[model samples]
Target: MDNNRLPQETLERVTEETDNLMANYNKYVEQLKESYTNAQKERKEFLSSGIEFTKLIESEETEEKILTVYESYKKLLDDRTSLSKNFLSEINSLLSLVDQQLLLLESSYEPKFGIQTQNPRIFKTNKNNPKRLRNPEDADGPQMNGKYCICNGPAYGDMIACDAFHIEIPWFHMECMGLFSAPRGNWLCPNCRPSE
Candidate 1:
């Protein structure tokens, strides 16, 4: 039974899939850029009309007409904002799918190190950290999302250790990550939970 965890073959698949996803994402971004360019051109055309909508707004005689033009411009701005959000959400969903697939692949794998075992590291969520720190919202990066414990206390997802997304649950440390693979939200400290 292939568990579909992060086996070498699975890694290869992830690499391929991630590459394709990135390509598609890039294509969408290019289209978005094109949309921005078109918007700029449209703005230029509006200006070139020489109607001077700004002047029209100040003149009571054409205030209503000027307001109409302003509303149209506001609509375009709103549309662009909405389009950007949709594009971001689309890419985010694709990345999230890949993340889940990797988790499955990692679980299916049984390391050859004689100690064939399920994940032993279990993390608890420590909501206290965020409440204590007055730092920016990034304080809640994935590394800091786990419970309070020895490994999970500090040194979460710095470059010297695991990346934010790859950190083991609970503790989010390097050693535990090697031993018992971490589930998405559960992870024990490497010191507390030794790998087989």
Candidate 2:
């Protein structure tokens, strides 16, 4: 065999080995590409499914729905609270006005009518004679004579004289004369009434 020329069988074996290596590398590359394509398809499917699931969760009634409902009703709740507070304030103002009026009435007038006694069975009557006529010789003047009344004699406090009856003895205490209501028109005591 010549030194510069390779043997035919050895060349053929080397060429066949190189061809086999290239075929095996091409097969590995094809498998890697197929695997990459499959991974991409799986990723797409996962992403699409995730989006659909998120949409379904959002559409369902959950915390978001509750939040929306709370937002809508918050104004009504605040309005009701304000109205109740205003109503209570008005009622309190009216109560204060009524209390002030009551205080004024108590300070302005003193109660004088409806005298209560301990004994319910005892009837009130004068101890001395009420209709006794003063002697003309003993009489001092008309003013001194008219100072006393038939009922509750001897007018000590405020007194009023009746113009209708008892022209002789007309002065009487307003409370003792049973003039509870305001003194209007001519008033006459019970002792001076004309006998029916």
Query: How many clashing residue pairs appear in each of the predictions shown?
Result: 20, 0
- Residue-level error in angstroms, candidate 2, position 163: 39
> Each model's C-alpha lDDT?
0.51, 0.48
Best by lDDT: 1
Best model number under TM-score: 1
Residues 1-196 of candidate 1: C-alpha lDDT, one tens digit per residue? 4443347666677678678767866876787687677667667655644376554445654655545555665666777787678767866876787677666765554432112223334333343444443333443233433453344455333212222344343234334345434446544345444569
Clashing pairs for model 2 are none
What is candidate 2's CA lDDT for residue 130?
A: 54
For candidate 2, the clash count comes to 0
Model 2 TM-score, 2 decimals: 0.25
lDDT of 2 at 97: 53
- Candidate 2 lDDT score at position 18: 55
